[model samples]
Target: MPRRDRPRRAAFAHLGPLDTPIPISTGTAALTLETDGSVLLDVNGVPSSHLHPDPEHLVFEYMRWMLLVIDRHLAELPGPDASGAASSPPAPAPHLAHLGGGGCSLPRAIAARHPRSRQIVVEIDELLAHQVREWFDLPRSPQLRLRVEDALGALTSWREKRFDVLVRDVFSGAVTPPELTTAETAAHADRVLRDGGIYLANCAAPPGSGLMADEVATLSTVFPHVGVIAEPAHLSGKRRGNCILLASRRPLPEGIDRDLRSDAVSVRLARRPQVEALARAGRVLHSR
Candidate 1:
């Protein structure tokens, strides 16, 4: 297949030709493309997504960890190598749903690497969604989908076991919405995913804050396996940043550490035991 025909991002700025301001409900977001072809979607003053067509160009540490989990899982399926040597039969294209649209960076990366994937992304801020769609030249329906709806509502409407992966990246200001972090929300994710499917979340908390623990416990209530990935600095209470959380109905993939070692940014994996220790120190949250 021709490279242009695939939903790959270009090495040049095709979306805005330059930076543009997009008004959102809270305020305005800036969508800018750098000379190097990286597109940045900023809400308030914080970058929500730094996307390039290439998966290796991820600028966010948490995003890299998220993609690492995804790539490792996909690698398990049978497939031919780039050299076209006969390998294991390829696994079926996995279905994925995103709770927060942001700059649509992860979805774009997934599309480029796993062209057979079907993705649906829900973004509450319609203006941001529109700007991202137009500026990024996002692929049209079937291949990629955008829904202007609340994350919880969208998940509630989804069919049971319809998706192989569910990603929760929604945020209000700098913090995750409390409503979305509750045990109830985790149950909703559990309902929509197939048994053994993966649920990934981008959670931000201050150093030594108990919010991460609460979230880990909430997810544990619904999934048998849970873990977290982040930079060692973030995990050690030396810095503040997003921690990539993972939950599944079955055992998680092995060699996750090995897989993440190749990321542009260093990452640390906190498996079920470590995450549970955190959860034990905090209270489980429920829907308000």
Candidate 2:
């Protein structure tokens, strides 16, 4: 494989000749190459995906923790090859269905690390999906596939509980679409996952806000276990940031904490007390 062909993002003010916005129907998007050869997919002036030339490397905070949770169940897979050849993971590859297509960064990372994993990314914007697939060179079916449709529609239509993980990372200009927030939508997502499966959503909001908390409450209606992973500042309502809202039917103590290391800031699960307070924020508003 000839490395990256995209043009690098030059100095701050000066973009390289190849840097151009991808023309989508509703919004603008662009892919800029970083100095280190990583790629960033920008949409509507928001940083959507940060992808490295090497798919194994996960660069974002939320992404690392999301992968940590998924990596909990599976056996340790081999590392990438020095010669850049491929090495498939052992049997029982994870089956994941991502609700958003963005740059398809997470799916790419999983495919490289767990080559046999089956993944389907559902993106509403057809043009965006086409551009991302072409620019990123994503994997094909049986390994990965693209579902070009609204996340909620796809979730409701999925007849079988086949996926091991259902990731709700969809966003329309910084906010997750309203359709994905309803309890009915959550129920549909729950039905799409197999037994002991996990649901992960990226909630970006300000401190003291109930966005993340609302997610906890919504998922709680369907999932037996719901918790959050975020920085201490966000957990304590001291700052604004993104938090990983994790919900699962299985018990949280069932080896789900295997990758919850102390050294990493976002790896720590928010204490029950903190989660209670956050949940209250959303619950009170919902009751009213």
Candidate 3:
């Protein structure tokens, strides 16, 4: 796709004075760390990218669609049983770690759904982290913590921190951090995840692009199971691109199909058969 032809949408809102302005692309998108410490990425004056806005956080339709799938994934699991039941649900309180905090949309959703889950959001830009807290009413419970540091750096420092689910949503312009996409990083993620933890990432792959194949190869190095949930366009082998990757140490929970169709946002998950094939074909990789 031509550089000029790429879709340029406003990804953030300007709430307050722009403090530190960092040029992200050559000159296309500029990120400003506001006085309130929230980071805003202005893509040619569009503010739709902000992930914590009131009506909606993320402007990307595909992202919003994927979140529904994730929401369904969380909801399908049986709730904890108080009394001694024949089939007790998994742990009531799940530990979650978000490697890339974008307006705290996913974290906020999780907090709302699974009130007992503890969430930690790590964002590389200090200003963005601050803005997320100031601009959005993210939960202030002891269960949530926001960290300002590089995603990989924060992952390395989390010696005692382990999680039941780890999500990677870090991206700049159209490229993801190479360091975070390597087999080494996947290994690190595995170390921090619990025995049955799940790892999901938002990967952008233009049609016919090698991005998905490359990521699948890299993640297959450290994860026992790897699967992808791609948009309908990508699944048809058409030119349109970008999709979500779901990897786990254990098999995906049952009833994913039913849960995905339960809501509007989640209906997108059922549109593609290729993603299901990839999920089923995921091979186990030997951990280092």
1 or 2, greater by lDDT: 1
> For each candidate, how many residue pairs have backbone atoms clashing (under 3 Å)?
1, 0, 9
- List RMSD in Å for every model shown: 4.4, 6.6, 8.7
* Candidate 3: tens digits of C-alpha lDDT, residues 54-145: 22334455556455545655665445776868786555577788887756767776675567878898876666566656555567756778
Q: By lDDT, who's the top model here? A: 1
Q: Residue by residue across 1-288, what tens digits does model 1's lDDT show?
A: 544565654563446535656667658787677666677778887778887756455777777788779877666544545565466555566789999988888888788678888899999988778777776777777878999998889988998998888999988878888888888889889889876788999999898787777788888888888888878787766888889889988788888888878777778787557787877876888976
Model 1 regions more than 4 Å off: 1-9, 12-14, 17-20, 53-56, 77-92
Query: Candidate 3 at residue 256, lDDT?
Result: 55
Which segments of model 3 are wrong by more than 4 Å?
A: 1-81, 84-92, 261-288
The order of the candidates by lDDT, greatest first, is 1, 2, 3
The local distance difference test score of each candidate is: 0.80, 0.75, 0.63
Query: What local lDDT score does residue 135 receive in model 1, on the 0 to 100 scale?
Result: 69
lDDT of 2 at 275: 69
